[model samples]
Target chain A: MTALAESRRRPWILRRRTRRIVPVAILAAVFVFPFAVMLFTAFKTPGDVFSTPPALLPREWTLDNFAEAFDQIPFWRYLANTLFVSGMSVLGTIVSCPLVAYATAKVRWRGARPLLGAVLLTMMLPPQVTLIPVFLIWNGLGAVGTYLPLIVPAFLGTPFLIFMIRQFMVSVPDELIEAARIDGASEFRTYAQIVLPIARPAIVTAAVFQFVWSWTDFLNPLIYLGDPDQYTLSIGLYSFFGENDVAWGPLMAACVMFTLPAVAIFLVGQRFFIGGVSAGALK
Target chain B: MRMTTIRRRRALTGLAFAAPFLMGFAIFIAYPIGASAFYSFTDFNLFQSPDWVGLQNYERLAQDSSFWKALANTFVLTATGVPLSIGIGIAGAHLLNLPVRGQPLFRALVYLPTIVPVVVGGYLWRWMLNSQYGFINYFLGLLGITGPGWLVQPEWTKPAIVLMTLWTVGGTMIIYLAALKDVPGELYEAAEIDGAGPFSRFLHITWPTISPVTLFQVIVNVIAWLQIFTQPYLLAQTRLNNASSGPGESMLTYAMYLFQNAFSFLKMGYASAMAWILFLLTLAVTLVILIGSRRWVHDGAR
Candidate 1:
């Protein structure tokens, strides 16, 4: 009983008997393990990669895989294409999502409730429902092979992002908007000057998430981009794997490089990103 | 007259703000919904005009073995994956919620995998899941347990996907953590004063408090899993960019098969029919869960 009391008295970091830390450590390790494998494997020589009784860490690290991945796929070109698409999308979300969210959330109109309901319905509806027809629409417009299929959707407010930003905006006090309106500011002026500045963090959250989604998206790019030169890193890595099925080192290297920008952005916007996900659940 | 003018202007301005999404909904969502439903009833390949076939696509779907296999695969993954992910996420949140040093670091570590690109995640999972040289089997062998070929064997393929599904559960964990944090601390103190143990406190207080969140997460997971594509596609893919359906077609999830029909086989009508079927099935499952939640979920609305 004395020992139990003393154990409970100690700071948890110093106590071995603490229940939570052990499981947290184990799960954290499991989470980090695949990434460790990705990193270690990227630096390993091909011989070491396939050697019997495989080692977790490299016997000898090499830069061969990084060079090979570049040669195997036009890494920089795909990177530029992905950056362009994802960058444009981040801009797109920043412009459109907040404008719509402000109208639905702050502006009092009878259509607002119905519009919010429509937003929820669209958010819940499966993308597969519209997959083929949308593809045909793009195919008809002759936008199939270009960035239009990839980038154009971003200009349209994504339902999930719109919903999230609106949830954030709903908390903005009505008095603020009313005061602005009473002062002879038009609705657009009120939204832009009074609301948008206050909603900047939410917009930033929306923007970062949009960039990441476009960066990581595969299915749309797979269908839309016909030419090999046009491939984003998401599917470009696939062709890399196809050509170098046995070249695990290069594949792993390419994957690490492919993953870095998103990780960096996630870390930078980590606070906003976590907040955005939960806002959907709670609000 | 002046007041009415102001009201009309405000209404029109609101309409102007929402125009992009409304236009997007009509062009991207509304038109496709109508077009797909129409196409589902006819044999309309990409280049050709629709030829009415009544329920032929549905009939073919009814009789198609590949469709059944795909359906079975999807059902198995969704059934197993959704519960495990929610359980882990909630359980993980509980653990993370405990006062400990470097809590943020641990939380970030857990979440780091989620931000990894799916293409990257898929390939990395495949690499780790490799039969002989892969780290997963290597670690298993070190523990004196012979690991199965995760990607090669048909029986193991779905489990591999489930395991991969579990890997990126940090997203759900973060959401659950947020929900858990929203639970007032005084409730726990009051329960403790009543001499209720931790388990009982969680059972009576925490469980009911987070049930709505759990319900939401469960529905989201169900919807996502039923359409699981990129993971299995990358996992089961063969070289030269062919989307192999894994060993013995075990990896042919419903969405993948639909994609195959739409793009590979160019069976546009059949694919559209499959799409509607998937949509209805998702709706049914979601409805069931929502209905069932009435008994369990404690709505703590502010």
Candidate 2:
């Protein structure tokens, strides 16, 4: 009896240990393999990159490819352009979206339901459906090839972000808003003080999402910003592929460079990242 | 009387909050959308005032071989890609939700693709699938099998895009993970107590619990797929001008066609008609799904 019980416990312990180790090992490989490959390719010579049984590490690790990547385009200029566009959009979304979300969530209004429904409807309409119209609208205003077309939409408040913040705002304790009202705080003041601070997680969440979207936004920048000098990193990368023939080594390096900022932000904000993504599922 | 005044004041304040969004909607969304509908009836090139053609563009679209080809390609992509991605997403989410150790790290790994800019992801895949010296071809060589030219061949191009899309279902997977967490634990326990197997438990307990999420993902996925542009556009534009658009037009997606007509060719009026047609297709598809969802999607929480 004692031997059987010990045997049963041993198998359970072994199974648990295997379960723990196997997933960790597999997960590490899944995340690290591509990153390792990308880093290795970034350093390789063109000859070495195209060779069979490609060197896991470059035959001669050097900064030659990185240098070439920089020379191939105005790397810093494109980076700066991307930063300006994405940064301004993130700031705009943060300022406008939360206030709009708070009103839709907490304040009583007649057109509230219809308005929210309208916003939801926007998601269903393919942005492609309005592409020509928006282009014409911007061209009429002479805002084509400028940052205004890309950045101004952020100020108007995005329907998606409005939905996210509203979902988060709905959960704020009613007493907190009531207490502020009793103290004669104006609605704007109450939102600024009580609501914004309380909704910090959702704010951080929204900022991170907006920043990523704005940074990676290839379609808008492609359509609006026609000038080579004004191109974002995304457009710059596309141009590299377009104007030049295959230069795989340098091209991968530039892609690596372009991808870094978004990855850095996501890693830093990982704790709050999944919450924002999951908001839609809950509602 | 005072309560009614308070209500009126609240209504004004609410409008005040929505003012920025409403203004943006009118200018950016509503106006442009309304304008497109009007333009669909005209013959406007970008350089001149639109001529009132009155249904000529729509009639031309019906006879346009390329338009039908693009529409068919878009449908094929959505029909294959959307369901497969959703299936992979839900499965991945369920696996991640198991009480396995290192769960957070693994969850982050699966989602790593989503954080990478789509442009970068596109280039990376382009390199990997390159016919000469690409990693994927090399792997097949090790198996004593020769790999087909993935992006270069027309028959292979759409499949290539579908493969690339599967890598980024991480966004939807995260949503599914959250929905799974909200499902009641007791339901699973009761299934275990019964003689129910894993498949049976999943069908009975898990499916019903997460059906709403499945419906939401399906609807959004179909809409997004109908607007597929970047991959096909990049693929088309990068290779040979029209060839990259789709394999001998095999990959010329409806969104790419709309984009080409609007921007590259500057056929604004024709593009507007195409956009409205797309709008109607999306609306019709969404309505079908909405009606069908009534039979499956549970609103137990509500």
Candidate 3:
């Protein structure tokens, strides 16, 4: 009887162990393996990159690919361009979205509900539907190839960010606003001083999201930024792919460079990143 | 009169606060939508004046084989990709929820891919899926399995795109993880006390609790997949100047085709028509999902 029980318990133990190991292994392999391959390829020599049986690790890891990528593309210029665009976008979103959110969330006005509804409706409308007219308008204004088309809209407030900030603002106690009013605070002053401070988390979430969106935006830049000098990293990378189609090592290295800032931002602001995603979905 | 003036003052303050966004919405969103709808009915190539042509663009779309093919491709992608992604997301969330030592690290690792610009991710996958030199086939070869030329073959291209898109399932997975955290532990404890197995407990308790989240994810994923462009576009449109579709036009998604019409072919009117159609289709799908969800989605209140 003891032997039988021990034998049964052994399978259960093994099963539990396998269960623990299997999921973690699969997660690592699926989620982490491609990145490892990318990093390895970035450092690999050109010869190793296209080798018949591709070595996961480089036979000779070198910085030549990164050097080559830099030489081939105006990496620093594009990085600066991306930073400028993203910075402007983040500032625009943070400034405009919170005010709109405040009005919709805190202020009792007849148009507030309708405006909120419109915001939600706009979120569902395909960007393509608006593509032609917006592009045409920008073209008419001669804002194409400039950063105006990209940066200006961000200042107007994005529906999603507005919705998110509004959700956060709705939970702010009315007493605080009342107290601010009693303290002789103007409406704008109450917002700038009291509401803004309390809504820092949501604002941070919006800033991070807008920064990432602007940094990674392909379609907008692809459409508007015709000047190579004005090119962001995304478009620069695409152009690099075009010119150096067969140069896998340098291409991967360029990709690694392009991806690093976003990854760093994500890692640093991971809590906000996770929080923003949930809020967008659940709210 | 005093109360009325105060109400008016509050209203003005509210409008002032919302003015920037309201103006932007009017100019960027509302105006554009209206203009696109009008343009859909008119023949407005960039160089020419828009000729009012009622239903001609839509009529042309009806007979356009490429438009139909693009529609079919988009449908197949959304039909298959959304469910598969949600399944992967849920499973990934469950795995992360396991009593593991480095859960946060694992979660972060999973989310890392999503932050990578879509362009970078697309190129990375293109390199990885290269039949001859790609590590994917190289790894598969270890098990003596020959992988198909993913980008070269029409039959395999969509599936390859699906695989590439799934790389960013981390976003959805994170959402599911948040939902999983909200599941009460007592219910699981009760299930365990009743000798319910893990799978049984999940089916009975965990799934119902998270069904609302699943519904939300499904709609979001469906909309995303319907508008799928960048992955397939990068995979197929490698040449900077070339506007041709990839390998039997297998990777010509609806949005890609619409883009070609608008930008490449300069069929602005036709593309506008396609956009309107896409809008209607998205609304229909979302409505169906929202309406259909009532049967299965369990509100915790119930």
Candidate 4:
């Protein structure tokens, strides 16, 4: 009995057992294994890709696939176009969403309730519903095949972004806004000075989220941009797939190139992604 | 008197701040909705001005056998995909929320797929599901079982898309994890004291608490699924025959069909009609969900 008690009291044994570690490890492997294969394939030559056992490591490491992918798709141009559009959209969404969110969350007005309801309703509608209509309108304005159709929407506040920021805005103390008001600050001035500065975290969160969405968006670019010069990375990759005949090595290389911005952005701005995703749950 | 002036000025300022969005909505949104409805009444190819034919597009849509097939494929995908994704998300959240070491690492691993572009995800999944050289098939072969041609076979294509979607459940899991955090520990403790087992406690306590979130997720996911395009487009293009008919039209979603008509075939009028039908269907489904919210969504937590 004493020996059993002593064994139970040992430091390692005393630690709380998860009763789940093995299963969770298995689940984690399932989640991660495809990415492992993708990374491995990106290093190989096209000739080695369909080898019988599917190598986890290349016998001869080569950058040939990456070079081929680049040459085939005008990858650098697509990357530049994608960066310009997605970067601007992030900047524009961050700038505009807060203005609307401030109005809804901080101000009391006759139209506030109705306006807020409108934003929520907008979130409910799938963007696909508006695809053709929006296309025709842009086409009529001669904006089709240009970046304008893609960039223009960012200047207007998105309802989903507004919803996220407004929820964050609700937690900002009314005392701060009122105190600024008493200090000879106009409402706009208080928003600029006090509210905007404090809402930086949420703004960053919105920016990162918007960047990911815009960067990865295939349909909007697929529809709006007619010329190859204006194509973003998503469309570039699509054309890459079409040209490559599903060449696993070069395809994976191109995919890695396309996905780098988002992965880098996420890693850099992880705190915000976690925070913004959580904020959506409160309401 | 001074207060009245301040209030009036504030209202004007509000309007000024909101003006850009309003203008964009009017020009880009409202104009197109009305114009698309108008176009649906006509026969328009891009080169030619629309000729008003009045309900002809709708009649043509009814006669379009491919439209019905595409619609059926979409329904089958959403019906299976949404529930499977929700199940995976919830299970993942439950596991992540438990007190465990290396929690943040696990969270990051799960969230990684969401950051990859959909095009990349589709291609990667295609390789993983390949019949001959795919790792999945090889593993199955070791067990004396043969794996079917997943992306190539018409019967298996939609299920293949569904499988790919399951990889991104991390997005939904993040939301569920946040909601699960708000579930009170005391309720679990009480249930445990009453001799309720883990499964029983989950059904009685956890399910009730998370039901609203699940409902919200269902609506968002269903609406998103109804517009499925990227997976089908990629898979269809890569299918062996190089066919636009898309794997027995198994991969031909409603959006894909709209795309084909609008861009490929240049049947703008017909595509416009299809878009309107989709819009109305989405609006109606959303409205029904909103009306039914009180019946299922428990907002009393606030």
Best by DockQ: 1
Error of 4 at B20 (Å): 2.1
Off by over 4 Å in 2: A1-12, A19-33, A242-244, B1-5, B239-243, B298-302
> In order, how many clashes per candidate?
0, 3, 0, 0
Q: Which tens-of-lDDT digit does each residue in B50-133 have in candidate 2?
A: 999999999999999989999999999999999898898887787777677678888887888888878877777777777777
Ranking by DockQ: 1, 3, 2, 4
The superposed Cα distance between candidate 3 and the true structure at residue B72, in angstroms, equals 0.8
lDDT of each candidate versus the true structure: 0.89, 0.84, 0.89, 0.81
- Per-residue lDDT for A1-283 in model 3, tens only? 9877886878886578567967776885787888888899999988888799888899998999999899988999999999999999999999899999999999888878998998898888889999999999998898888999889999999999999999999999999999999999999999999999999999999999999999999888888988889999888886555444567788889888888899888888998888889878886
Q: Which residue window of length 10 is worst by lDDT in model 4 chain B?
A: B238-247
Candidate 1's residue-wise lDDT over A171-222, tens digit each?
8899998899899887789888988888888898998899899999988888
Listed for each candidate, the true contacts retained, as a fraction, are 0.80, 0.64, 0.80, 0.56
Residue pairs clashing in model 3 are none
- Docking class of predicted structure 4: medium
* RMSD (CA, Å), each prediction: 2.8, 2.9, 3.4, 3.0
For candidate 2, give the lDDT of residue B111. Answer: 88
Interface RMSD of 2: 2.4
Interface RMSD of each: 1.4, 2.4, 1.3, 2.6
On the 0 to 100 scale, the lDDT of residue B209 in model 2 is 89
